[model samples]
Target: MTELREAAPSAGTDLLDERTRELADYCAAMTGRLRVIGQRLDRDPDAITEFLHEPQVRFPVQGMLPPQYRSAGEFPAPLVAASSTVLGQVVATEQVAYGDPNVILASPGPSLSGGVVQALADEQQRQRYFGRLAAAPTHTFFALTEPAKGSAALELETTLTPAPGGGWLLNGAKCYIGNGARAQLGVVFCRRAPGPWGIEAVLLDTSAPGFSGELLPTVGLRGARISRLRFQDVAVAPEDLLGADRSPSRRGLYGATYILYRFRPGIAAMALGCAQAACDYLRTHRATLPRQDRHRLDGVLDRIAAVRHRTYAVAAAVDAGVVDVAGIGAVKARAARVAEDATRLVAELLGPASLIEHPWLEKTYRDVRAFELMEGTTNLHTMAAFQSLLRSRTALQPAAQRAVDGAARH
Candidate 1:
């Protein structure tokens, strides 16, 4: 227990802590720059469109390291802090909603691919694939959700069959994939048949033959570059298989689950930032509203504050290495709700002006809707939270356990 506790701090420390004012200040300064960039992007429609497709706009190459610094180690806490800060800044600007498809693809997008590669790929394989990021501004994606199989992501229809000589043949389509059309590399999930072990993932170069992508238009997050990808006998090398080559990992969806657990909190923070921005906007215009309307706005502000604090608490726990996986889902779901509700309230306060005149709040309403569906759906989080609660209750039921033990003895 002592050793475990000792090892935990190696992961990262809380930037929010008073002692870490330097780091906090650093994050703030960077976010301020991001805000300026976001505002700039918002002004030019063509610039924002081009920015969506630019690899550097979302995942800046400046944040990446040289080959010497790269290693197959646990994710650094600083990356999460930096990512959350970037996302929050962008969301707050209510610019192009850069965080969702951009930061989502930027941070966790690579993290998921890197984690899978590290966990499953050989050392040589790791160096080849992971090196691409540092080599240049590369875009990578995690393609799991299909049009029909989003909710049942584990039950993949994409099939991977053994190629004639040495690789696997990939055939199927993936939809609503962030950065899919633009990514240089991606981890595509597939199955041999249907059950747990059948579900597997493979790394592939997006430029490979037999692979094609069509950009999927979205109501919100126009810059996200979401794509519907079709793979027609796209050959994947044996080394490209995640976890293990040839045979699939029997544990079933463990890799996907791990990625979600690690990244969901940051995504939640993105939503929280949106909510905070809405509250901030509302507060600025609060005095102009009628007296009766002020009370309702105050109530909305309190709810937004609650959600923001809850998100921060979860982020702190994550940094301390003490957060429950299920708690991430809970926090994300709550944040999504708060963001959606806050934006709706703001729209109501602004009336048609928000919809017609101001693109900020209008875009935000659309962007926040994506949060409830992204990372994990609200229903999925609800189930996870309920399951977590049940487990906690069982752990605390000492008397019931004792009764069962006595019955067995008798």
Candidate 2:
């Protein structure tokens, strides 16, 4: 929560600030390139490497790096500032995702791993890796999902045992790791002993001996290159362990929690963007449709606006030192459902064959689905929201009883 409060909101009456608006305009310009290469990348996931030089692919990646690590000249103040903050990223991601979520998802950058880096990496670790990323366009993955269990603390089977000579040996298999196969460097989470406190994170090099990553089959977001990684006694240097010098309590699973808090807004924005794209597409193609369908589209658009504002508000709250996990969870879950519903409604409105007829819409229909699986599942979020509801009921009891007592006296 302390780290969450670090990003102060820039001065603005509107939800978006001037810098955020500038970044949005810049992202809007890059949409054409993403639209162009999206299909190609879908057909061949490896094609992501070919477009590294493109602004859409290059800028967002550069935008995520802090000013100090940015090797690129003068970290364009607008996008660069937005790049570091939750609210800034929320504005940028929604716009970029409008064109194609795959463009940002598949691009080589810190991305999902950046939050973890910020949450845990020490000065030396940050300088060593972020510096390398700044110097070149390198794909990165945040390895948490595992072969058997999907990041369940107790069920996690990955191990980081001490090596015979020194340091540690990483042995595990991670599934559903985006950019895992192609990534030259990234972070991996594993357990050194048992229980939650056993968890430890390490800076991982794809080239390390016994480390292997392979692309997994994906129906949607084919360009995302969701992959599987295997580590068989892969050696980890002492310096590679994140927060190793800290006490066991400080080095536990909270860092992972912090990363989730940091990125939930951006995740919601991705879904919102996808939903908006579908709605806009349907409006353009089916404007002459009967009044009923037009009204339905209007309702959908309204929902997007309401949810967009909610997403922005939650992001601003986090920036202002209020990390309302319940609100955030509800927003992320609702955004995802809205995205799915938008695509479904648009498909019906656009005609039965629209999915087959329109290539981009079809890709979008497939792409929006991947968001539900990102960060956390919708079910998990809804339950968190429900838990908050129960807590709120208890929290209001004292005031509620005082009001009742005053009425009784009267």
Mind giving the per-residue lDDT tens digits that candidate 2 earns over 1-410? Answer: 00111122222317877777777677766666677777788888788878887767777666678677764554476577676678878877877777778888888778777767777778888888888887787888988888789867556788999899999999989999989999999888889977778888888989999999888788998877899999999999999898887876666476677777878888898898888878877767765868887788888888888888889888988888899998898889889989999999988887889889987888888988888888789888888898999999999999999999999999
Q: Top lDDT: which candidate number?
A: 2
What's the TM for model 2? 0.92
lDDT tens digits, residue span 175-211, model 1: 8887788788878888866678778778889889999
For model 2, what is the alpha-carbon lDDT of residue 19? 74
How far off is model 1, as Cα RMSD?
Answer: 8.0
Of the candidates shown, which would achieve the greatest TM-score relative to the real structure? 2
The lDDT for every candidate, in the order shown, is 0.61, 0.80
Residue-level error in angstroms, candidate 2, position 331: 1.5
